[model samples]
Target: MSTIAKEIESTMELNPGIPIKVLQDLIQKKYQVHISLKKIFRAKVLATKKVQSDFTTQYLLLRDYCAELLRSNRDTTVTIEVEREFNPTTESRQFKRIYICYGCLKVGFKQRGGEVLGLDGCFMKGPFPRQILTAVGVYGNNGIYPVAFAIVEAESSSSWTWFLQCLGNDLDLNIRSNFTFLSDRKKGIIPAIKKVYPSIEHRYCPRHIHENMKIKWRSNMFKNMLWKAGGQSVMDYSTMYDMAANGIEGGIPESWVDEVYWLSTWKKVNENTIDPINGKEMWTPSACPTSLLPPEHHTQIGRPKKARKKSVEELSQKINTGGKMTRKGKAVTCQVCKQKGHNKRGCKERGPSTSTQPTSQQQ
Candidate 1:
C-alpha cells in the first residue's frame, strides 16, 4: 500500500476520480511489478484521506464558517439544524439541514430583480448523499441570480417545507414581493411552495411538462401543443381582460413598463445601489464542538450515476460545442409497446402478457 500510495500520490490531487485499473497499470509501469486491483483501491482511499482529510472534520468547521458569513456580511442568513439523535459513543449529532443565503444575493434581489423565481432540488452525490434545494431570481439582465440554497436530508415535503420557510424568513416573503414561482413540479416542491407562500402564483416549466407528455404521447402534434401557450399575444381576448389577467403589463406603452424589461436603462449602472455584502470572510472559533460523524452511506446495488438523467428534449437538443446534429425529441422506444420515452416495465400500453411476450421462448 505504501509503495502504491507513493506512485499515485500526486495524481489524487490532480484527478481524484482516476480509475483503480489505471492506477494498477501505472504502478506496474513505475515499479516494474504487477499489483492487484484491490490493493490499488486501498492505496487510492488512503491517498484521498491524506489529501482531503476526513469529511467528518470538515463538518466540524461549518459552525465557525457560518459565523464568518454573519460577521462579514450584514443581514446574511446561515442556518444549521441537526437531527435529534446523538450518539453517546461519539458525542456527535446527525446533520439534518443547513440553509445559506449570502447577503450580496439578497441585495441584488432587493435592488433590481424580476418577479419570477425558479426553485429546484437535486441529489448531492457523495458519501453523505443529500439534496440541495435552490431558489434563484430572474436578474434585471435576465440572468440567473442566486437568492438562497439549502442542503437537507432528502427532497421530501417536510424537507422542502423547512427549506422554503427558511427562504421566506430571509426574503421576508409577503404579498408585496409579488413573486411568481416557476418549478418543474417535483413531487414535494408544489406542496411546500403552497404552504410557504399560499397566495403566490406557481407556474410550471413548459419543457418539463412536455417531457411528461412524451411518456404518454409521442406524436408531432403532442409536441407542438406544449408550446401553444407561448408566442406573440393575439387580439382575441377582451383587451381589458388581457390587461388584467395574462400579462404582467399587457399592451403597455414601452415607457410605462418597469425599466426591468428595458435594456437601455443605465442610470443606476454607475451607482452602488444596495451595497452588496462581501462573500469572503473568515472566522476562527476559539472552542469548536466535537466533530460530527461522517454520514454512513450503505453500499447499494447497481452503478451510481454521476450525471443527472436528462429528458428526451434535453438529450435531443443539438450540441453547440462542436456543431453536432441530433435527432431531436427522440427517446427510448419500449420493446413491448413500441412507444418512446419508456422501457418495458414503464410502458403504460403494455400489459403483463404483452410485456412477457418479448422474453418468451418458442416451444
Candidate 2:
C-alpha cells in the first residue's frame, strides 16, 4: 500500500467518522502529496468496512467487557441490554444499551462533589451508532466529576430513566429532595426525572429557554428582560416578568415567563455548603446567589453547537503555522440521519421510540 493510503487507513481506524476532506488536507500538509478526493473516498470506504466489522465484534464481546470491568473494579456496576427482535438471518441478538459506573468514581463523587448533578447526552459518531448519556457532578473546587454514563440506542425517556435509576442505585441515593439536577429541558428528560427522582430538584438551563423565546420574540428588549429574570431573585424575577409581559411592544408569552419563574425558584433552594474538594466554603444551591445554570431549552433541531474549546493537539499544530485554519460553514449534511443543514449530533431523526423496553440493572 502507498504511504498516503497507509496513513489514511490508520487515521480512519483511530477516528472512524473523519471526513474525506479532512483526511485529504492532513495528507497534503504532512507528506506534501496532493491526493485526489476520489482516492480518499476509496480509502474511506475500506476504512468504513473495517469499522463496521469491529463494531459487530464489539457487540458480541460486550459480555466479556462487562465481566472484565467487574473483575478489575470491586463493587463496580454494569448493565447491558440487547434488542428484543429476533434477527433470524443473523441468528444473533442485536446490541441495545449498556451502563457503567466504577466504584471509585461513585465513591469520589459522593465524597468530594456537591449534591447537584448535570446530565446530558452526546452523539457517538462511530461505526456503531448510539448516544452516550452522561451524569456529572460539580465539585467544591469548581470541577466536573463523572458520576455515571450509559450508552443507549437514543436519548428518550426510557433510556434516561434507566440511566438515572442505575445512577441512583450506584450512589445509594436517599430518594429525597437534597439532590439537584441541571440539564437542558430535552423532550424525554423531564418525564424521566420525574419517574426516577420525583422529589429531587430538576433545574433547566436558562440559556436554552432564551433560544426558544428568541425565535418568537427577537427584540433586544425582550432578550434583556429574559436575562434579568434569570439572574434575579424571586421578587426581582417577577418585576422583570411584568416588564416583558406588559412593557414589551408585543408582550412576552405568559407561558415562557412562567417557566422562567419556575427555574428561578429551583435556584432559591440551594444552600451554602463546605466544598469537600477544596476544604473551603463553596456555593450550594442555598448560599450561592449566582450559580451557573444550564440552558433553558434545547430544540434538538440542527447540528449541536460544540460545548468545548479546541484541544491541546489542535492548538499546538496551529501555533507556528502561518496558514490559517478555516472553519467549515455552519451548513452541512448530518451524518446520522443523512439530512441537509445539520450535523450528526443534532439529528432529529432519533425520537423516543415506543418500542424501548424496560431498563436493566446489574452490580
Maximum-TM-score candidate:
1
- Over 129-215, each residue of candidate 2 has an lDDT whose tens digit, in order, gives 568999987644345767789988789999998898888888777567578889998998999999887889988876777667767
**For this target, which candidate reaches the highest lDDT against the unseen true structure?**
1
Against the hidden true structure, what lDDT does model 1 obtain?
Answer: 0.72
| Whole-model lDDT values for every prediction | 0.72, 0.67
* Model 1 Cα lDDT, one tens digit per residue, 84-128: 774655666667789998776776676664567899987665456
- Model 1, residue pairs in steric clash: none
Q: Name model 2 segments beyond 4 Å from true.
A: 1-4, 10-41, 85-91, 174-178, 213-363
The candidate 1 region of ten consecutive residues with least summed lDDT is: 265-274
Q: Tell me each candidate's TM-score.
A: 0.67, 0.56
